[model samples]
Target: MTARWKPNVTVAAVIERQGRYLLVEEQCPDGLRLNNPAGHLDPGESPAAGCARETLEETAHHFVPTALVGIYMARTLQPLEGQSEDVTYLRFAFTGTLGEFDASRTLDDGIVRTLWMTIEEIRASVERHRSPLLLQCVEDHAEGRRHPLELLHVDPSVAGAP
Candidate 1:
């Protein structure tokens, strides 16, 4: 059997405060780009947990996911030096409360800094975004299309079952 195709599962936190969104400036495979606090879902953790963890790791802030913005399937051309592939991503985005940061904490590798930028600013920097979903999540958030947390139910009998 050709290896079963399984796209990496990622979780992103759309943390907004005042009138700006929290963004992480990191060095992706493409280049130095902007993206929400997002990361691959770790084993034995729910999407919410992953979002919280990624936010803390990238921005040194605690994020409490309040609502699911929406799910997205985005396919794009991926070019690596010379080897390119068509990659599809399944992203779970959540909007929530952005708590205080831990100044003592160290940011993850490749993460240069975090910034709070207005949606317009983000839009202007679309060319620098690591992925297209970076702005899509923000747009969906601005539209107020959120699903309740209850939309995801983890069965107690099985670990990592949602």
Candidate 2:
């Protein structure tokens, strides 16, 4: 049988403060890349929770996912490592408040540093993004795109399923 196929549901944090947006510089297979603090949804957590956790892991910042900026589906043809193959992903993006930074925390592996970038700067670095959604997330956020946090409900039974 062919392997079961499913698009990866992920969350991204588009954190803006003082005219700049938060971004993380990380090492991807393609080389150094920039992106919103994001990661795959883990078991037993809501999308907001996933964004909060990923933000902390990637940037050491307390992330409060206050709004759902948008739901995004992205596909990229990327060569798999150590194999003659390609892969893709579907990302869900969110925008919210960035709280206090925790200096004691360590960033995730392959993550180098976190910085703030203005929209113009972000637009100019299109080539540095891990995927097109990087800039799209930010643009949507800048356009006042927002959804009530309650739009995503975590069914307790499904959440707790093993």
What lDDT is reached at residue 133 by model 1? 98
Root-mean-square deviation of Cα positions for candidate 2 versus the true structure, in angstroms: 1.6
Per-residue lDDT, model 1, residue 63, is 89
- Model 2 ranges off by over 4 Å: 82-85
Candidate 1: where is the Cα deviation over 4 Å? 157-162
Tens digits of lDDT, candidate 1, 10-101: 99999888889999999877789999999898888888889999999999999899999998888888877888887888899999888888
Question: lDDT of candidate 1 vs native?
Answer: 0.89
What range of 10 consecutive residues in model 2 has the weakest lDDT sum?
A: 79-88
Q: In candidate 1, where is summed lDDT lowest over 10 consecutive residues?
A: 153-162
The local distance difference test score of each candidate is 0.89, 0.87
